[model samples]
Target: MSPHSSNDGGFAKAAGAPAPQTIVTDAEGLDAALVTLPGGAPAYVARPGEGDTYPIVLIAQEIFGLHEHIRDIARRFAKLGYLAIAPDYIIGYGDPRTAPDIDAIRAIVVRVPDAETMTIFDEALAFAATKGGDPSRAAVTGFCWGGRIAWLYAAHNPRLRACIPWYGRLDGARTKAQSRWPIDIATALKVPTLALYGGADPSIPLELVEAMRTRLKEAHAPAEFIVYDGAPHAFFADYRESYREEAAKDAWARALAFLRARGAG
Candidate 1:
């Protein structure tokens, strides 16, 4: 979805958000393209131009779905020598990329069941293995809408070496499609996770972040939560006004280190 699109009823882009600063990555050297997953879903795959095998990183997209920003994220991981695959996990709810507004995006999001998405991830990993991806050395990271799913995927997939979720929701009302939140899985998390949050994010309260932190500590889960003071939600989204260069750069460094430390690098 175009964050600058005015058709979103003012929900697509935050109010007073800085003028859109879309950053597009040139795919001049990387092997990047739109490929079909084993399950027939469309996905963006990016990797080094010449690699016998590379670590796998599955990128989860924002509520806007598989847009250019998300594709750029995959390319970023590819630059770090990863076989990054960003699948269109938001299937069956229509295309959020072209959705007229946030309400339309939200409607499709609420209907996406975790079970289906997890299964799609399973397929995506299998697809990766065919493209010189080492499944044993794999990680998962997501932004905004995908961020929350990253938490669940870390718990669901034991093979993942690391997980990093950026500004994902910690707690929320449960539904048939979404029966669990990050807080609900904190105590059971099995993979090393580095979670980044915006201290000023109005949608996600600091209290929930603290609660999740407490739960992880109590369970001795391998996870770290970092809050960037005064940073707004989606601070890593450079295309939007919420982007904070300092927080985003620091978080990116921490994410790469976390993944590499756990052998996903």
Candidate 2:
């Protein structure tokens, strides 16, 4: 099935909704805008300084595509001195921001295939290389749905130095399109991965998380999974109700250390 395109119409926040925060300010040196991914998907890219090669970090979005929250994330990474690129993996599908509710967002997400999303990620990596990024030192990080992709990408691309998957589902009912779960690919991973999850997330059961840990142990995969005591899914998304500041801050610190230790800095 062909992917759906986002319809511009929807209930956008009122003008009074809090103004979005800016995370980076190298105005003269930074380049910020949409760049085309392979297969024509559009991705937002942000860089810290001109002519300086920096480690690349692909910031995968939640089901929301490259919305303001995701954009802010890219800027935050840029401020940290990495070239961060966030692609609209769902460009072929409808926009999650336009969805009236969660069901509509899920409908769009389910149509996006793992293979297709990986291709877009590859494109984002290529785009980063052209903008002064060290391709050999690339890393990826994501939230929620993007988190699962981060794990799969580590297995898919051997050049990746590290991966950080935040609050992603570890196991789920299989579908024809999603042939392998993160646990299924753990043994084949070429890079180290750190998975941060919420202990109380209903969407991802604690049992499944334990199963993933067991599989990783048996395979001796270079992976680590941490569960925050009372956090819920999307705890890192400061814009939503699920945001848990304490857990999110801790996870972010761990993620940075994980990536840098793997030579992504």
Candidate 3:
């Protein structure tokens, strides 16, 4: 494991105690479990509200692994009447939380092959099925690095009903295993997707977003991108400095509506 500091640039320390806002109420019955990935790595799983079959929405983590914020996201979805699960796709890699700085996190992320991440997602889908999730109605959503994975997963899994990628980078220098960009697969998507982005995000320029839109239009993919004018990256993360409540709320409403339209709920 990489030597991690409790304080890092992109990653935050895990919450020591629950926050007072009360985003999810019926979360008592939900238990966290560990599932073995295809490569025998252990990944965390959070079950649905009442342990009943519900349409599943696979939650992907940010550069940070399954931290408190990501876990809360799963519970928040359960409160919305859907089964949401997030797996630790970076299980074999060093824990991002333990990394001493953002550079360490970035190094770990770069070393993680896209193919291996996708395989873990497939295992997450199988794990979701055991928790009473309807695989046929499964959808996927992700933030930051996870957002890029959301797009890749949509292309990889034809069974997906919908997808939402939040503030993920649209373009980057291609690696061997990460040859395909989102634009490359935009038109080949079988599932509908909604991409939420921040117009002010320097990491992901608006021009790239526009290029992705053009590709989606050309391919006739059921995909849409929304940019919040002044919001920066990670605007939806309330615990972070980039939180934009109004924009986050609006984007979340759109995401829920999009999922419901495609039968994810």
Candidate 4:
């Protein structure tokens, strides 16, 4: 086990949690599972059943943690011939999945240190190598809370080929655990990044998104931002009421194109 992993426990079912999406990707042609990594980190791993090797995609989960939506995303990546791994980095503090409300989930989220998260991702990469993943061909995509993480990870790990963050926060309070936001790291990004945002997201205003864009441009970072005019936060989360199919599909397609162009797909 890696020294960085936390073996607190697995995810707990949240009371009154919304039902999963009905259009989830299946494992018909994929090898997928909820497995324990070498460091004892829990993760949902998915890959093409017939492939000996594939590009790797490290998926970051929303505040809800490694729920059905995240797992489904992994399957979708696998179907596209990528080895997708979604590690449960927050299980140590407590299962955010079990939180009954947004505030309850935030309590668990703030405790997760950004430094520790980078290590967990490192472990995920190690595990991916053993599962026929091409370490040199790796990309990351995240949603909600994970979307913010995707931006940080891109800045932290230069080896990543690309990063795609779906409606991640651009600015926020600086806590010891989470000292930086997407906007703070814009100048430090080394990998090509594609950030998606909802124009109607009350949590992340347009001005902040533009501020991030300005920083990235000043730093000459290879980055792009796509804002859906009327989409709400979590537009890609089909299981949530905020899901916007048109925007989600468009974003997903653009993400794939960006990854491929950046040598990750």
Best by TM-score: 4
Q: Candidate 2 regions off by >4 Å?
A: 1-29
| Model 4 pairs in collision | none
User: Residue by residue across 12-124, what tens digits does model 2's lDDT show?
Assistant: 23211323332223323455666676579988777775557999999888876667677767767777888899888876878787676777888888888889888889888
Q: Per-residue lDDT for 173-215 in model 3, tens only?
A: 7988677667778889878899999999999998899999998
Worst 10 residues of 2 by lDDT: 1-10
CA deviation > 4 Å runs, candidate 1: 1-20
- List TM-scores for all candidates, in order: 0.92, 0.89, 0.88, 0.92
Estimate the lDDT of model 3. 0.78
Ranking by TM-score: 4, 1, 2, 3
Q: lDDT at 119 for candidate 2?
A: 87
lDDT of each: 0.85, 0.79, 0.78, 0.85
**Model 3 clashing residue pairs (backbone):** 4-98, 4-99, 4-100, 5-99, 5-100
**Native-vs-model 4 lDDT?**
0.85
Q: Which stretches of candidate 4 lie over 4 Å from their true place?
A: 1-21
